[model samples]
Target: MQTYEIWDSEYRFMTIVWDNAPIGSGALCTLCLQQLGWKKSTVYNAIRKMCEKGLIQNENATVRVLVPREQVQREESDAFLRRTFSGSLPGFLNAFLSGRTLSEKEAEELKKLIDAHRKEG
Candidate 1:
């Protein structure tokens, strides 16, 4: 899988694309203008940069993501956790949950996900 690193500004732009894609490029540009207050040139610049990076595809004036949102999110999340938490998920969770109470449903869902992963691995 191809992974791309997105800076904070670019992530905002990409989030819009991820949320509203397989949309017409013109439509996406319009949304960017309305939602993000971007001009056409700014939107086109971002689109071209992302397209060159293989993060998105613009063909026939239609825009679609080349990389799925989950994949990019996972990669970015993993990188962040590794860098900030020394690659220790338990450590990261401990820090994240410090003085915090998770709801039963949230805990159950997390447990289920962990169990499924364990079983799969």
Candidate 2:
């Protein structure tokens, strides 16, 4: 899998693009200004950077995501969990659920997912 590295600034920029992609560049710039407190230069710089990195494209003043948001998020989550928990899913889950409570529905859904994966494996 060809996962690209996204720095914090780039991630923030890509989030906006992913959320409003296939959007007019002008409208994207306006949204960034309102949501991110970014200047025109900042938005343009991020646009150029992501374009060069193959994360997005600017064609005829329209912005489009070259990589889907789900792919990026999955890659980022896997990388983070591996790095932080030495590739241990239980360790990662323990840390993630620490000091937090899941709703009954969420707990049930998670249990079902675990059971399904276990059966598949």
Candidate 3:
């Protein structure tokens, strides 16, 4: 899978697109102004950059996401794990859970997920 690096501002912009896609460019600009406090040029510039990165498409004055949200999230998570924990899931989990308590339901769900993905070996 290919992953594009997205900055915080771009990610926030993408979130709006992902939520209300196939939106008119003018509408998108309005949304950016309302939600992000961004100006028209800033919205257009980010859109152009994202288009160049193949993360979104602008056609007929309409904007839409070329990349799905899940893919970007997976890529971000994988990169974080690799960079922070040397790709060790256990290490990452340990650090993430430190001083944090999971609810019973949350713990059960995680346990089920781990069981389902456990190695056959």
Q: Which candidate should be chosen as best, given TM-score against the real structure? A: 3
Candidate 2 has what TM-score? Answer: 0.58
Clashing pairs in 2: none
lDDT of 1: 0.83
As a whole number from 0 to 100, the lDDT of residue 101 in candidate 1 is: 64
Q: Write the per-residue lDDT of candidate 2 for residues 1-121, one digit (tens) a residue.
A: 7667777767888888888889998999899999999999989999998899888999999999899866564235454435467778897687777834678899999999999999999
Q: Give Cα-based local distance difference scores for all models.
A: 0.83, 0.83, 0.84
Candidate 1 backbone clash number = 0
lDDT of 3 by residue, 1-121 (tens): 8667777668889999999998999999999999999999999999999899888999999998899987664235444335467778887788777834678899999998888889543
On a 0 to 100 scale, what is the lDDT of residue 23 in model 1?
A: 89
Q: How accurate is candidate 3 locally (lDDT)?
A: 0.84
Q: What lDDT does candidate 2 reach at residue 105?
A: 96
User: Per-residue alpha-carbon lDDT of model 1 for 1-121, expressed as tens digits?
Assistant: 6556776667889999989999898998899988899999999999998898789999999989888766664235454335467778897688777834678899999999999999999
Off by over 4 Å in 2: 73-121
Steric overlap count per candidate? 0, 0, 0
